[model samples]
Target: MHMSPVRDDFRRSQLAIAALFFLLGFQYATWVSRIPALKARLDLGEAQIGLLLMTCGVGAAVSFPLVAVLMRRFGSRLLSVISALALGVVLVALSVVPDYPLTLLVLFCDGVAVGCLNVAMNAQGAALEARYARTTMSRLHATFSAGSLLAALLASGVTAFTGTLAVHFGLAAALLAVLVVVARPGLLTDDAPAAAQDGPDQEQDGPDQEQDGPDQEQAPAAKKDRRRFALPAAATLWMGLAMVFGTVTEGAMNDWSALYLKDVVNAGAGLAPLGIAVVSVMMVLARIFADGWRTRFGDGRIVRTGSLLAGAGLALALLVGGVVPTLIGFACVGLGVAAVTPCVYVAAARQGSDALSLVAAMGTTGLLAGPAVIGFIADATSLVWGMAAVAVSAAVVSLCATRIGWPAPEPHPEPHPEPHPEPLDGRLAPDAG
Candidate 1:
């Protein structure tokens, strides 16, 4: 099929947005891969470490509500640039922090930046997808996983060579900053074009107008437009909850998988990260084809299946309790969650950027909260049981899968009809029917 100029513009925008996703993942994994080293340096216990990790989420949660206001005022494109810069700076600070409290402070700040970056970038991605008039969320998320996988591999190699987080993270921070600067030109400013916005609403609104007159059709549209940037409705809330469940599973694996393997499975430094790599690769692989699966099976089925797989996979790994079995289990977990977030994000984007930010924030809380939950559990019982939280999260997502419902389609403005001339008598209207 021949591509139009508009599609090509969106395609470029998509690439730019995908680059941002990749960088975000890369930054996150770089820090996560170095957690073992940081843990040893601080000599913190499981509970302390968990609480420390929770600070990131706390910061993010605090910032979530503000994202909508920020986006509304400054626009997502600008926020993406500023938040990414903040993220890079915080990451560099994390690498060199001397004390635990300072590290906590830095991580809290990192979480704030991350909160902005997460909502902004995803909102931008959703906007681009809306402009393109198709499903691009999975592919964008796949790029993120790909970045995380690459970063994990690089961190492993860098740790082997430099044996320091400062050098590894410093270089990564510099690279991301430069790349984002270069890609800033391609980021999108608008959620959707006027033409694209009106088209779908027009088609969907046709039947409603036929049932009710144009005046009735327009009242709801005007009301909806007035509230467009306000609070999300019930459906958006449900979507956000679904995001929380999926993110809990994903966040747990990202933050704790390597540490878990090293402490629990007795895997060596080199091998421990490999467990996370298995999950990362599986998630990347699953997402690579998620758009296609979505095309064939639809969002509901993909989410339901992915949720089941994630839960079952984690349970299997936790039950088997070894390096190899755990790896296999995490791999299953990865595949299961690959499609869930992307689908949810896409659904929210279809609504509008406001809805996207609200849902994204809700979902992000789940991701950031997972590590803290696991840490507390591990401190109380064991890391194995703590890790079991991922399985539980997966189960929650499976149950909530049906709640990831589509957004209410926006109403289109009815085209004004041309005026008809009256008859010569000026009393009887033309076309008296």
Candidate 2:
């Protein structure tokens, strides 16, 4: 049977959105894989590098308000494309920036672009789910992990050939440009809230109903004002907390896994990058099947179980204290927490766009800043302790998972009742009740 145009559009949009996710992950991992090189080139201490990361986080944290406004004005589609292009430009700038201050400025800009893209792309994901009534966010996130895996492998390969940031990041940026162009047309244009597009129709409302027109107009404005200052619900806060903790575990590993291998395990330069590769590989594999698990087990059970697995597994690995065990632990962490953020994002989207934006921003902060926090911890104590903190964060995610209200499983449709036989008489039969 031939598919309708709408079906084709949906498929295209889905692929396009997945590409956006992949783009973000690939760009991010390219830089993240080079953290060790950056530290050495800048001749920075762990604490100083942490401070640099903190700057990026600060930029991301402060960007939510601006991102919110931009989303309202431009809609998620345009904003996603624009921010993605900006991210590519920022990556190139990062490669060329010479001084420490200039580099920090570029990173701050990168953070802003990242924050905007994160919120915008996730909004698109939520919209896709709403329109299609499917659980796709997890699979979309899997593409992200795939991108990271590719970047890690590429970084390793490129390092062997040459150690030039300009060459590596330039190639990554070119790839991003191609993907952004390919994905833009397929992104959903009608992603804005329905209320925003439902202009007053004079023909629909009779003269008698005109009296309520002003009130109807004022209602949205009042709602908007209230939303500006309103506090998040307890459930929303819990979800955000889970996101923070979940991302802290994820982000810390992305930034520090190599260093942990190099410094703690003495894995040497050749093997250090594999730490990130291991996590990305496991994350990609787990996320590939996470949506199916969510359908069967529900988001709550999956999150709680996964978080516990991640925390306990990592903690055990640290205790074992060897390169092989540590790599195994990172893989566990990846597999266990792979679905947490996507589940949390789905739950937050159900709350409304405001909560979604807030939670996404919080997650970005965790992803960017959490690694820096680990850096400071490593400086003050040891890298092992810093990784222990990641384990603790994973445990906290499990705790928060228990508290937050997850979406209930969709109820099965009931079977149609059998038709009662017509009464012999002309009159209708009496009700059983």
RMSD of each: 9.5, 9.1
- Candidate no. 1 TM-score: 0.72
Residues 1-433 of candidate 1 have per-residue lDDT tens digits of: 9866656676788889998899888988888788888899888788878777788878887775577667656777898999898888987898778999999999888888887888778877766544443457788988887788789999888988887778998888998988698779899755432211231244465578688977787777545534754656666677788898888898889889999899998988999998778887888888888877775666777888889988888888888888888898889889999989987876665555566677777786887667778889999999989888879888888777665554222132111122122111111111111
Report the lDDT tens digits of candidate 2 across residue range 1-433: 9976656766788999999999988988888798888888777789878777777777888787777677767888999999999889987887777778988898888888888888888878866655554567899998886888789999999999999888888988999999999999899886654313221221233342366675675565436524542766677688889999999999899899999999988897999999998988888888889877876777888899999999998999989988899999999999999999998887765555566677888888788679889999999999999999999999999999887767554342121122111111111111111
Among all candidates shown, the one with the greatest TM-score = 2
Q: Which candidate achieves the best lDDT against the true structure?
A: 2
Whole-structure CA lDDT of model 1? 0.74
TM-score of each: 0.72, 0.77
Model 1 superposed RMSD (Cα)? 9.5
lDDT of 1 at 342: 86
Residue pairs clashing in model 2 are none
